[model samples]
Target chain A: EPEVTQTPSHQVTQMGQEVILRCVPISNHLYFYWYRQILGQKVEFLVSFYNNEISEKSEIFDDQFSVERPDGSNFTLKIRSTKLEDSAMYFCASRGDTEFFHFGNGTRLTVT
Target chain B: AQSVTQLDSHVSVSEGTPVLLRCNYSSSYSPSLFWYVQHPNKGLQLLLKYTSAATLVKGINGFEAEFKKSETSFHLTKPSAHMSDAAEYFCVVSGPTGFQKLVFGTGTRLLVSP
Candidate 1:
């Protein structure tokens, strides 16, 4: 079966540096989403995208965060400036509709 | 708005024993419910989903869930637990209305003991 794939399985960056996490969603999937999980915490939704625009976002998705589908297959999440709290497992998920969702292995972001 | 609550933060079961994870949901409209499992350092894997279909939905890994509208619950159950069943499970809900944004529960960690 086709699966969502993410690049840079793990990343380490300086506290004030910018970071980009990339994902290639399943082919033919229309909706894409980004979520994060702090160590030992529940996964929190960050944002959702459809038609190359953001559909909804959570409070955590502040000005520092932005998502782009620069190409047909790649969906990326960019953090303008990384904070210590931004260190977490960021996951990319895709779904054609409500019935099923496919998630990528996730990119572990570590900011020091 | 739609939300899901997983009753137990952790559950321990012996191998071959039955498994049950409880979940309750609050939704203003008919809801779409799903159960997902995540192993260490892995991504979320969809186990099953309920979308106004039959109340009893069967999913992968010998798992099943019953959607009880009267109780506003969608509980996951398995006839027997295996060692590989040890993982974190999340309960999620989505509103039937357009936008279909998913809201996830805190999660339930299952530990299958030998």
Candidate 2:
């Protein structure tokens, strides 16, 4: 079965550095999303994208954050300035006009 | 607004015993519920979903969940537990109110011991 794939299973960066997390959603899917789970905390929604634009975003997804399809199959999340609090497991998900969302294994981001 | 509550944060059962994970939901309209499991350092895997289908929904790994509108609950269960069943389970709800955005619960961690 085709599944969403994320790169850099783990990342380490210094505070104030820029980082871009990459994801390849399932082919033919129409919607994409970004969520994160802080260690020992509940998963929180970050942003949702459709039609090559952001459809909705949570307060956590501030100006420091942005998402882009960039290409037909690649979905990327960029954080302009990483903070210590940005450390978490970032997950990418996709769906096709359905409530069912397939999630990627996740990228563990650690900022010093 | 839509939300789900996982009653128990953790549950322990011996191998071959029964397993139960409780969940409660609140929604203004008809809601869709789902059960997702995540092993340590793994992604969330959908176990089953209740989209106003049969009241009792069976899923992979011999697991099932019941949607009870009267009780506003959708609890997951299995007759016998296997060591592999140990994982963190999340109850999620989505409604038209939020463009089908899923609201996840805190999650319940099940431990199956021998």
Candidate 3:
């Protein structure tokens, strides 16, 4: 089965550096989403994208964050300036016509 | 709006014993519910989902969940626990626009012992 894929399973960066997390959603899915789970906390939604634009975003997805399709197969999330609190397991998910979302293994971001 | 609550934060079971993880949900419209499992460092794997089909839904890995609208609950259960079942379980409800967004419960940590 085709699965959503995320790169750089682990990322380490300085507090003020910029970072871009990458994901390749299932080939035929129409919707893409980003979620993150801080250690010992519940998973929180960051943003949702469709038709090449952001449809909705949570408060956590401030101006520092942005998402782009870039191409037909890749979806990227960029954080302009990282903070120590940005450390978390970021997950990418996609869904087709069905009412189910498939998730990727996740990218563990660590900001020092 | 949609939300889910996992009644138990942690549940322990011995191999060969039955297992249960409770969940309750609140949704403005008819909801689509799902159960996901996560191993220590792995991604969330779909266990099963209740999409207004049969009230009882069976999923992969011999796991199952029942949706009771009157109770607003969707609880996960397994007849026999296995060591491999030791993981974190989350109960999720689809957002109003369907699967566009998922609201997840805090999660229940299942510990299976021999």
The best candidate by TM-score is 3
Superposed by TM-score, candidate 3 places the C-alpha of residue A50 at a distance from the truth, in angstroms, of 0.4
For candidate 2, write residues A1-112 as lDDT tens digits. Answer: 9999999899999999999999999999998999999988788889999898888899999999999999999999999999999999999999987888999999999999
Who is ahead in lDDT, 1 or 3? 3
**Each prediction's whole-model lDDT (CA):** 0.94, 0.94, 0.95
- The CA-based lDDT of model 2 is what? 0.94
Tell me the spans in candidate 1 whose CA falls farther than 4 Å from its real position. Answer: none
Per-residue lDDT for B58 in model 2?
96
lDDT of 1 by residue, A1-112 (tens): 9999998999999999999999999989899999999999998999999998999999999999999999898999999999999999999999885557789999999999
Pairs of residues clashing in candidate 1: none
Question: Candidate 1 residues B1-114, lDDT tens each?
Answer: 889999999999999999999999999988889999999999999999998989999999999999999999999999999999999999999776555677899999999999
- What does candidate 3 score on TM? 0.98
Deviating ranges (above 4 Å) for candidate 2: none
Give the alpha carbon lDDT tens digit for every residue of B1-114 in model 3: 889999999999999999999999999899889999999999999999998889999999999999999999999999999999999999999856643699899999999999
What interface root-mean-square deviation (Å) does model 3 yield? Answer: 1.2
The positional error of residue A87 in candidate 1, measured at the CA in angstroms, is 0.8
Q: Name model 3 segments beyond 4 Å from true.
A: none
